[model samples]
Target: MTPSSALKAESPSALETISRNPRIRIRRSGPPAEDAKCVVYWMQRAERAVDNPALDVAIDVANELDLPIVVFFSAISNFPSANLRHYVFLNQGLRDIEADLAERGISFIVRRPPKNSLEALLTELRAAMVIGDENPCREPERWRSVLAHRLKIPYWTVDADVLVPSGLFPKHYFALHIFRPKLYAHFPTYLVKPENPKPVRQWQRPPNFESFDVKEDLTEGWKHLDRTVQPVDYLTGGTHAALKRLKDFVANDLAHYQDRRNHPEKAGTSHLSPYLHFGHIGPLTIALAVDQALKQKVITKEAYDAFIGEVIGWRELAVNFVKYVPAYDSIDCAEPWAQKTLREHARDKRDPVYTLEQLEKAETYDELWNASQMQMVKFGWMHNYMRMYWAKKILEWSQSPAIAFENAVYLNDRYELDGRDPNGYAGIAWAIAGVHDRPWFDRPIFGTIRYMSAASTGKKFNSKLYIRNVMENEPPPLLT
Candidate 1:
């Protein structure tokens, strides 16, 4: 069946994008068998079964072939640069996905690939066709490319994580101004309702594999890390938790989102970044809920539009930028003019240099910076506006631009539930290297990149109130 015809046959939802390839590619090594009858769905990025475009597409192809669909999840014992906090959050999400798939009669198997050995497991699975979630990050992309070459059968990647497929954009954008119009053009088609997964008539289960115990692994793993640092206790990780948070945000917080989003004291911003980063809850689900609220007149048009602008516009904008620019994580990817200015001011003396260790401990002199760090330490997440200030302060306080970038990325990835995401990388790049930002007033260390300071935050909002709130509610960090 033609891809277009297949899409038309399904629900007329704008949430899904169809694959044009006749046969999905498999990256495992083997000669193609004419009657090889299995479609293996990659379950790494898009963890949730529902509101997932890749899973939907894989199911469609499997149904057409009259073959059983098997879901594959590879949990490497040690993902590069991942700390205890990162592991705990991801493992929790995986546990939830496993249960969700079991209820749908889809077999789920997780294999702990030895450190740096994903290919070995792919060879063992010998999947006829492989469908993977598309991500622009280094590790996922590297794995995808290696699998594509080794596997003889057709392999395909679906853009399930973003509102618009990353392939739609050509290059990294300078800022929101450049990417907003492009996203707005595609918003109507991307924001359509999603089709529910059709139940399988006959269940065919794969061999049972032991599910990894997230809590146990986390407890054992914490002993290996420095005993001084603590884990974040902001929100529990999982698809179920993510869905509940989204529902609560829509029902209560979204109406006040426009007004209190910038206020660090208010629970106005939807604390769904970590869940979205892990793909526990997809952007489509969030978009659909917001759209419904707008139609029901629960949120004003202005509020709804504001929310959509972030979910579809800015979020996809970052995804598209990373997709097109392979070196987006590097400082060289910044505009030539910005790079020149930054280089010229590379050695400008910082007022008070803070080592990565000091920053991690929330020991900085600035009370506001300390408060934001405490939030990350205690809650595993920081407010959206504070995140901007928090990152910018890292640039201002560190010994060098590169060191500052490394420190910010490491601390965020280690502590925040939403760290190590494409958005996380992009946010860091924007904060330190000016990836999507334009040059502003020249300053030491920052050069021409826009500068943010606690003073500016104080001028904008009640800084004392923000600090007081965090101190009052701060939870003890996760124990080592």
Candidate 2:
């Protein structure tokens, strides 16, 4: 069937699930194989089986072409700044994907490649066409570029990362106010629930198929990986856990979300960041559930609107910003005015300068700052509002703005389960250099970049209560 006719064949729910312009066809190295055994999905970013456009597209195309579907995921053994904690979280989610695919009679293969060797695996499989998920990070971007250049088969990138797809805004948006109307206009179309595409033929292992051990020892066996940072005992990873967290939040805390979201002590916010970061659940799934709650009167319209704005509005805006803005993790990526003003204040003296070690060790003078650091370092997450305060303080205390940006990114990416993501990068940029925000009243160290003081945190919420609650059980620091 032609591409247009394929869309015409799908029901409204299925159309809502996949995208109209999901496929970004890379340069065809050669014509597709006439009798290829299977359609290959190189799962990179969107790691889930459900509510994932790339997987759905692959399945749909496989059904159309009368081929079986095989999902391949390469586990990069040396991911940047990834420690035991990061792997543990990722492995937890991957286990779920493996089991789910098994139940569906789909073949899912995972391998730990040496370096940029995904093409070798594809060659071995003789894939007719390869499909992949979209991610804006430097590493994945490079991988996709290389694969597109080298692969003899056609490569397609399907963006399952954002509600309003990245193609909508070909340029960087200055602010959320500018994108609000654009987002709302597409909400009804994109927010509908998507059904999984069923294959006409299930995959079976070929006689000469190469198979490596899919078993993982998240706790101990991965000696090749860095194991310094251990996983948090509290949070479990996977779609099941993410959905449960969403259910509890909407049932209890969502109605008061607007008023209580900023208060770290309340613990009233939805703790779904890790799940979203891992692609355990897509934004549409959460948004649809929230919409259903609104209709059922489980949550008020005001609460639903506020929650949706954060998930669809602010969250998607961050994704959009990172997608369009090159050098997104660095201070150079800030708006011209922000860059100029920040440079103007570069020489401003920082009192009681702290090294990255001091900051990382949570040995700072301020108890609140130390506690917030402890929360992130120990728990692998931090409340969003406190994160703003945390990054601004790094700028205030570090030797230079450049160094401050580096330190903030390092610690955030190292600890947060949601680290190394666009939200993390954009959030740090907003905190340290004011990327999306407008110029504020000029200050000594902050310049025109927005300033967030620890004292202001006290005025907003009970800082002492938060510190006490989060840091109550931490033991004293070990001597060097």
Candidate 3:
């Protein structure tokens, strides 16, 4: 913020501050319908009712128009690579929103497509306007654009999930150093904890257009939904679960976060990626909790800074990556230097080129790489350090950079709970195509792209224990 606009940001009154804030972007025509009933909040990316900028804007606008707000969420069976596991977790989150909204005298309705649609629901409810949350990914972005063109009434979206509203930064950031100062400089205006407000008038249930039960399996009858990948048992969805995990991490594991975060054998890192990806928790909520922990002298500043740098820095950087870069999810998104270097050595020969099936079946010769794959398959997550190693090895084993990108994206999206996300895409690009990373020593297949030797990376952590965990959780044939 400039010296002229550096006012002390009010924490409790954060919602009010964001009423006409830069975080909001108008998608459709303005001037809400004069003879309309309720305001519909098209809950998309940010699923939670707490500490959500999107929900805050809906309430603020509804209050101004003297109308009750109705939150409408639609669950489509085929969301790119979404499967049964992803739907289950999403359904759990919808239930959480249902209960949370009830407490605040708001309403939540979950609908499906073909028969049930957002436009139909809005028309039935006679909605004055619509407030939605933002998603930078290609498909979701296209969804919002399509919806905006369809809706006649005022439609706007808030960059709810990200701490820094992605719209503010218009360019693609090459590295953290280039993006760090620019992001932090605007934190004064955007980074405070958002106080989610209740609607001024409670939602009045209409006589028609019934909503699906949140407790039931919404994707049960949809054959298009992939049921091959079953939901894992280790993690539960919902904002309450996210908060519990956050509190536990801050109280117990944060002190050792810096030291043990890279060790795959230990649970030192805050396993909040799934929650963050699903919008079960807001970034500000986690940030404020960590800052308070630091203030209480529970964790050292070094640990605090390190955690923030990884969780906050790298995350928003990925968001910026997806927001600006058109081909973010492909090998075409790699830097020019990386592209040239990789192409120069494209035909150098992959000694043990494994097909997608072999990699998916975890039949790789490298024990540690196989363990990382197993971790993602069995646990729906992999250690951050191992993920880097995992992707780098795919590059070493694939025919070309484009092929590596395809295989990595396929496995990552198919297994991990937080798959099909900016972070996952950026991570794969970094490991395989060198998106955010600097060029390193030239190699045969990898070229200037960074290389992670399995032998060297294994020495950094307890690979034996990690492999043991995978073996115990995975089927016996997985290791062979």
Candidate 4:
């Protein structure tokens, strides 16, 4: 039979393989007859066994090769620029992931790295083929590139985070308007129903390795590591909680999402950004659920489209931006006009210079800004709409644009569970540096990044009520 004919004749039930780079390959390797041909070195994303493209592809490849699949997660002592808050959230998520994998008949191995990158751990695992969830961010991408080069075996990077693969589009997107049409056109192709994992009848014993409890090791191991950052205690992490949150949102809040999402006090939003950022829930699952809701006529197309725009259009654009522009995290990725404008406005005078400590402690003069900061500090997440106003205030209050950008990133990464995401970086850049944003009415420090003010927020919604509710009810350190 011809290769094309064989391909056509194959069962339609087979798992679909999606690759960004055509040169990437997945092959059977390592010990013979052991039934562990494809070993997935799971990194970046966590939790759900369902709706995960990487885990699904790995399982399918293992089944085809008649081998069992083993999933490995490497925990390094020191992640570059990561603070105590980042570790706390990630560790909590991982703890939940370990339990979930065990229930699914998959072996979960946690290997401790000597340092941040998993170079030493991957080398020690001798994995036949390492598979990781694609992340356009600096650390994960750097780690993947190092692994692909250093590992003797083949490596696969799967786009499980975004609805559309980052590689499907060109390296950088011009703007949200430009990227929106492209995402809408490809939604059908990437929004297929998620494949469920068929339970494996035979279990493959994992090779003996050192067990590193993320919580205990993180606390104990901090002293031994090169870095001196503290561990955070923000929001609870892990797949179980993420799934629970999704179910809760759908049952309790999704109906009111259209009306109350913009209000900070209502808890009407999904609050899934952190989970999405960490890969606890796949974008496909969210899309499917939202699509189903739309079909049921539970949500208006306008509302559904708005939500989808965020997940697909805006989110994917950020991923695409980072993927193409290597210096996306830096100021160089900003448009030339924006760069010049920001530079000119960098030294502009401020109403009051708020130190990083003041911002971090939510001690700003604006009660609304303080409330938002408190939310980020205590809950580790913020409403999407308010996040813009929150970030813009930081730009206005700091001594300079550069200092404002630095403080904004520091606060977000330290407090928000969804911090360290491409979206987070893009949001900060958009607020401070005007990356991907068009020029608007001139402002002091922002210099045409589009200004958002407390008055504007109040005009859009019941600002007084929202502020009162958050300040009174959202719990302390924040309420204080």
lDDT of each: 0.72, 0.79, 0.86, 0.68
User: What does candidate 3's lDDT look like per residue over 1-480, in tens digits?
Assistant: 321132224212332344447788777644678788999999989989899989988998888778999998988878999888888888898989999999989988888767568898888889988899999999999999999898888677889888888888989999998998988787777667676787899887866748888999889789777898999778888898999989988998898889988888777888899899999998999988998889899999999989988778899999999999999888999999999999899889888999999999999899999999999988788889999999999999998889989999999999999899999999998999888899999889988888899888999988898899788984211100
In terms of TM-score, the best-performing candidate is: 3
Record all residue pairs in model 4 with backbone atoms less than 3 Å apart, i.e. clashing: 35-68, 84-230, 84-231, 84-232, 85-232, 93-238
Number of backbone collisions per candidate, in order? Answer: 8, 0, 0, 6
Clashing pairs in 2: none
Of 1 and 4, the candidate ahead on lDDT is 1
- Best candidate, lDDT-wise? 3
Q: What tens digits encode model 4's per-residue C-alpha lDDT throughout 207-288?
A: 5555566556454546654333344343466677777777776666676677776766556777778778778788888888
User: What is every candidate's alpha-carbon RMSD to the true fold?
Assistant: 5.2, 4.9, 4.9, 5.1
Worst 10 residues of 4 by lDDT: 23-32
**Per-residue lDDT value at 91 in model 1:** 74
lDDT of 2: 0.79
Error of 3 at 133 (Å): 0.5
- Model 1 CA deviation exceeding 4 Å by range: 1-18, 21-33, 114-126, 199-203, 206-231, 473-480
TM-score of each: 0.87, 0.91, 0.94, 0.84
Candidate 2's residue-wise lDDT over 1-480, tens digit each? 323343344323343333346344333333446678888999888888878888888888777667898998888777777888988888888878887777667888777654225687777777777889888888878878887787767677787877767776767788888888888898877887887867788877877565444455533445677777778867888877887888888788888888878887776778788888889988988998898889999888889888888888888888888878888888878888988888888898899899999999999889889988998888888888889999999999988888899999999999888898888998998998888789999998889888887778877888888788777854221111
